[model samples]
Target: MKGQIMDKKIIVLLSGCILAVFLLAGCGNDEVSSEYNIEYLNKDKTKIVDVPYEPEASDTDGMIKEFLAKLSSDSDNVEYRKPIPNGVEVTDYSLDGVMLSIHFDADYSSMTEVEEVLCRAAVVLTMTQIPGVDCVSFYVADAPLTDIRGNIVGSMNQDSFIENPGEQINSIQCTTLKLYFANETGDGLVEETRSDVYYSSNVSMEKLIMEQLLEGPQTEGAKSAIPAGTKLINVSVVDGVCYVSLDENFKNQDYQVNEAVVIYSIVDSLTELSTISKVQISVNGDTSGTYRDNFKLSDMYDRNLDYVVSLEETGVTEEE
Candidate 1:
């Protein structure tokens, strides 16, 4: 009986130990699999762009906090620069429906107009990329944001930043075109200005932008997003959407950049034209499909400036 009692006690202890191990394993597996692609401003501060990062926390709030930490200017990644001014920090954040409210310390009130707009743009672009989050609202110590128009913005979406037209000059000899190209790593897009691109009465600004993009980047560290020999078949604008049709060679090219890089490179470059708000791509007249099965081309894509990589994120300071 004594030996039987000892054996029973051993079995009970082993059972408890097994249960504890299983519980620990379950906890270890709880981390979320989703990665957040956060946006930051480029080196010249002309464009905002994104870089991918995996948040360490499993909960929504924790994931956002982890993202804010990366955006705090203390992160190790060279490509994760923060638009939020130095000494500014996200005190807290919350989500309701499609809106996210971020509360900052009092220091946030000190940012200049451009600084505040860019900072808010970065946060909204970064957070909205996450599933189920569409809009963002800013707060400082529970006070809401008031626009220059005197109306409090309930929330701001991507549409809040519309492309305002710059001064346009029409001359008989030549015209300038603005184009966006992929960075060397193919992780971001860089804006390149083609000031003296020769164009006649037959050449449209839309055509010139695509032609310049296909010609590839002039800057050393920038790269061409379009594949070689990809000819632009036609471009037209109906309503607010720009229809871009390319040749069959556009589909089977050997460009190694991310699909987002390739798609946005074209979409973003053309959308720089204030006349276009969205773009639809077609390969060999087939608008019902996608490019390389990566993304559906049938759907119209707005200029995803968020996919452009920030030059600030690409450089490491000497102190690091």
Candidate 2:
């Protein structure tokens, strides 16, 4: 009887150990199945689609390599397209802190403007999913990548390519803008209220404002002081200062408008946002010299309402 009892106890102990081992194995499998989405351009190459992916690698370095390889390879699904174009190979990459710098061959420069932006958006969205990476910068032929306007395409993160929650790219949203434009005489600024301005959510408010300024004013008696054909290179706000970079076309001036009118139109329009207290304008990222002859590009400008004309002064009435 004693021997039988001992045998029964031993059997129970073995069974418990086996059960524990199986539980641990199940946990390991769960960890392996942890999901992350890999972003890819759709068949049309106009939009990005996020596909569920389970990376085999457990470490950050391994995950980076794995994701990059996946980005460069053809997607198994025919509807999805590879982010990296053919003949454009990644030469090298390095990680410093949270920023990842990727260098590509000369062929990367051959991609069209739209293709390049989409590729960049896809890569940024994919890599930023990793635990350690927070931002990405691209290099072509050992030089930093530049936008079509020739301004440096600096580091980008998930926020750089924004998408509405539960919506795809180019999601439209509406807002009101209190834009300042040149008056009829072209020597003073006039406030124009634009309501229901629909724009893509992917575009930042600063960029949207600049675009509208370039598009000119819709209200009567208001004219756009900004030169036509000017392209916005980049717009960023840091520490209460909004930096506006434009293409070479910005240097072309309409002599009829006062320099301050042109300058304050931008400053006042941007400073309307609570985040910005000052504005700094640059041309192709170059801040040296002056805009036309008086307004210095290097100087930070505060909102000057002195140039803004009242509605009555412009022979316009405010709608009650």
Candidate 3:
């Protein structure tokens, strides 16, 4: 709908004759939900640990339904996410000023300029259209989002969002790492690096870092699980399983593909140590056996988790 939608290009010039085939396809095929409803709750946003909750009389899904009924849908307004073909589902809706935090399920963890531009456009447009949102931040599930190379995209950096984007991709959701290598012509747009980022929390005296993040220096494959210098911030080993604690920087929201890479990273790296069977994750030392998920404002998520401390059999709250 912008500037008389451009005409598709399909032209053939033969014998000094020119013929152009213009295809006009209406972008809208189905009715996308115009707006969503939200519920305002009073939350004390200060805490630093985990607190498990009992299933409430009312489920959170119902609350979500009520919340979505509050959006404005005057007309069929559409957000044109060009360049980026389509965005898959993660978290459904994000109200900027109200939530201040936004969670998105990654369609693909390996980010590129295409995703970067999509992000800028998506965040800005969503916030502009919705009420109660002044600024917006993105997250994976409970971790920070990253770039194609498994670099975590934590806040405090504005220069890279739109300009030099590839520098930020630390990982995909659940640990799928896709590296970017310059093409044969030395161009970086070809997206050729492919490897599984691994993890190795069980092996003591050795930490993971970029040096060990991948195998063979630069070649892509199931590389070492622990990046060199990734000291074991905290280690909780029970039975044959090891519950490793990593620094805040190691965690990201969009760690999907990176997670797969992590499993590969750990399994492959530790196969030589002792062939340990099970591995669990605890970000910054909080363990609920939760998945490796995070939000954008990862700095404060642990604090929130701490607020909801575990409730014992007596149904009384007790701090861990």
Candidate 4:
């Protein structure tokens, strides 16, 4: 009986030691994990945007794992098409200057086309947010990973995903655009010269500039005359006349700005492009849609810089 009691006591003591070790390890791991911001596609999948997340580990692999785990879990606001598969794992990672190379388990080799793109977009956008990381490449079983189009070409940055926006990769070429935005008082428009990236391959430069106008200005003292949630449906040019189609969001307004300011904002901005001489606005595909300001949507407008207010005089801009 004495021997049996001693053995039982020894077994209990060993189990207690193991449990303590596990608790300590878990505590240490928690301390090593940290929080940071990462960009993910919005729920509508319309834009590559940023949000905050607490990761499981502070190291590169750990941060990635936590990001992938959150992507699969849908605990955040963003949309992710393929969750990290059950058997897939990040085996190793290396950061050499701006490039990040991540090796995964064999399961990574079997992702579907859509899954591959979404997964790659998620990884690249999230990892590149790291201070020194600019590009990302993947590997499976020591082999270069395949992309959405099944190309084995290596290395991808923000521009690699430009053909698909909200994937948020910008392969942008810088160009100057003379865009008009609301001055500080919202009473008049202001001319702001913006050096922005050229992002569209399917549309004309004039149309892209109009879309940027709808995206609003990046300048501090400027405000967008376009209504919030407004989307550019289509833009076409014929004989120097640019026809712009916007969604129904354009018809509605919550804030009071001079109606002429809004109209001339579009006109002056697009006419700055050499290909465009005039602009005709449309709402929800209807050329006849007119606002209360008596400006007919059907009218072809020429540039009217008369309404542009000098930023030096107003000394005011919209508050973010």
Candidate 5:
């Protein structure tokens, strides 16, 4: 009886030891699987780490912060002879299902605060068109975003079409109008990049005191009109304007423009698209030595302007 009692005690103790070992093994296995699911890219191979949930965008804030940190480091080495100007910095982001709202600052250029809001909309439209995302929004320098008219902006409701006039001239007003279309349409609207900048904002409201602004040429559209051989060599932007350098094309070929044409091209493009108050024109990279003296794009030079040229005959005909 004493031997049997001793055997029974030994069996009970062995069972408790086995139960403890099994519990520990189960807990360890759960942790290992959790770690494997949370993988990361370290230049090449994936590194696994333990995580608590199925990582969504909410779980991605820390990851994005780390990614941007590395991007900022890489950008430090980028050199600039003319200095590649930086736009507003994207500081924070909000994502609700398919819509992504980014927060940014716009003090880099003195253009306008409305640009920050519109620029982000361009980014959002590009992103939302992807399979998962459907729309995007922005906050300017931590404040709510408004349009050129100071109205609140948001994602388009029901699809809409945005129009393009094709290669006309290079005016910020024109480009900005196109940008507005993209924001309104939620898609890209570049008809043809050309090599001609116009000098007017016919659509803009006029002012007494104006700063002469220049516009970018229609780089792609001018291909058909320009000599078949010209190609774009370099492009530059300063103070919210684009400056393009072409490797010499058909300079002798003439299209007509009068003072009215010149003034209309510059001011119309500006006042229509932006709140800009003035404009100027340059051919190739140099200002025309005789632009304002007398109009000279052939017949285009003879038309009368409302302010500069009186409607009364200044030699420009109705057809001219």
Candidate 6:
């Protein structure tokens, strides 16, 4: 009878150990699962919505494939829409170092400008969340993606699409810009203080400055120094120097504005950003020729306040 009792107790102990092992395995599974934010466009396609998702795949490559599939698939929530439209298909993808390049079929090029931008933002924001992926680049029909303005849309990260606090993505933010425009006589620069300028968070400060300069000045005595019809190809900063590339239209100079005035308008406005201390202007990425008669496109210009005439001197009041 004692021997029988010992066998029963041993069985009970073994059962308890088995139960504890199962409990620990369950906890391990829970620990392996990770939550990631998947970006999608709203129904109206005006804003990007962040949806929390727990991917089944834990490995980097597996997560990327899962996320891409999810992006193209329908969202469980009614309010959100898939960023990759139905007709467009991701043909192929490759990962190199930290950069992920996704190639799309020709249908991708058919998307509207707004659709394209929102899609690009969504993909970049979502994919960068995966480990081993730091940036994303898009390709269509074997060609690198280009913006509406014909500039190559280079690798993009989270910072490429600015998000406002409390507002998820592509929200408006106010900023103040100190811009330089040509004086009425077109011989010197006039300072223009534009405050409360509302713009999309997606736009970088450097790009905004260039767009505003292209829009011309609101002040009475100030006029745009950049040639009309000129298109911005690209604008970026590196090592304290801002590189600005424009289309061939940039060579169409307004002879009335002094070459120096046109050059300084760009140089001083960009130098306003602490990150950029010098400005380099390029035409189609070629830096070899003179701008017109004097300024060389290859030269990196510094801030020249000497060319900047006071608003008072231009007979323009601050209120104007």
- Per-candidate Cα RMSD to the true structure, in Å, reads 22.1, 16.2, 22.8, 21.4, 25.4, 16.0
**Candidate 3 lDDT for residue 248:** 60
Candidate 4 whole-model C-alpha lDDT, 0 to 1: 0.63
Q: Which tens-of-lDDT digit does each residue in 48-132 have in candidate 6? A: 6656678899888998899999999878777778999999999999999999999999999999665776688778878988878
User: Could you give candidate 3's per-residue lDDT for residues 4-82 as a string of tens digits?
Assistant: 1111121111111122222122235234222321111101111001111122224334433332222211112232212
Task: Assess candidate 6 and give its TM-score to the true structure.
Answer: 0.52
Q: Number of the top candidate by TM-score?
A: 6
What is candidate 5's lDDT per residue for 1-320, written digit by digit as tens?
12221121100001111111110112233553322121111111111111112223333445344333322232221220101114536677776876666666665234333333223322432233333344556566876666543557665311211122232221122222311011111111112222222212222222211111222233221112222243344333345343333334524332433333333433343334343433343446554454445633222211122333221223322221
| TM-score of candidate 5 relative to the true fold | 0.26
Off by over 4 Å in 5: 1-87, 106-118, 156-161, 164-320
lDDT tens per residue, model 1, 139-238: 8878887754344757876544422212121112345567788777777787667665543223567877887787787765678888777888998888
After TM-score superposition, the amount by which residue 132's alpha carbon in candidate 6 deviates from its true location, in angstroms, is: 0.8
Which rank order by lDDT, best down to worst? 6, 2, 1, 4, 3, 5
Poorly placed runs, candidate 1 (over 4 Å): 1-173, 315-320
lDDT by residue for model 2 over 13-121, one digit each (tens)?
0111112111011212344433476677666665566566788997888988999999998788777789898999999999999999999999999986556766887
So what's the TM-score on candidate 4? Answer: 0.48
Which consecutive 10 residues in model 6 have the weakest lDDT in total?
9-18
lDDT of candidate 2 at residue 162, scale 0 to 100: 48
Candidate 2 local accuracy as lDDT? 0.77
Tens digits of per-residue lDDT for model 4, 223-257: 88877778888888999999888899987784567
| Alpha-carbon local distance difference test for all models | 0.65, 0.77, 0.32, 0.63, 0.31, 0.78
| Best model per lDDT | 6
The Cα error of candidate 4 at residue 144, in Å, is: 23
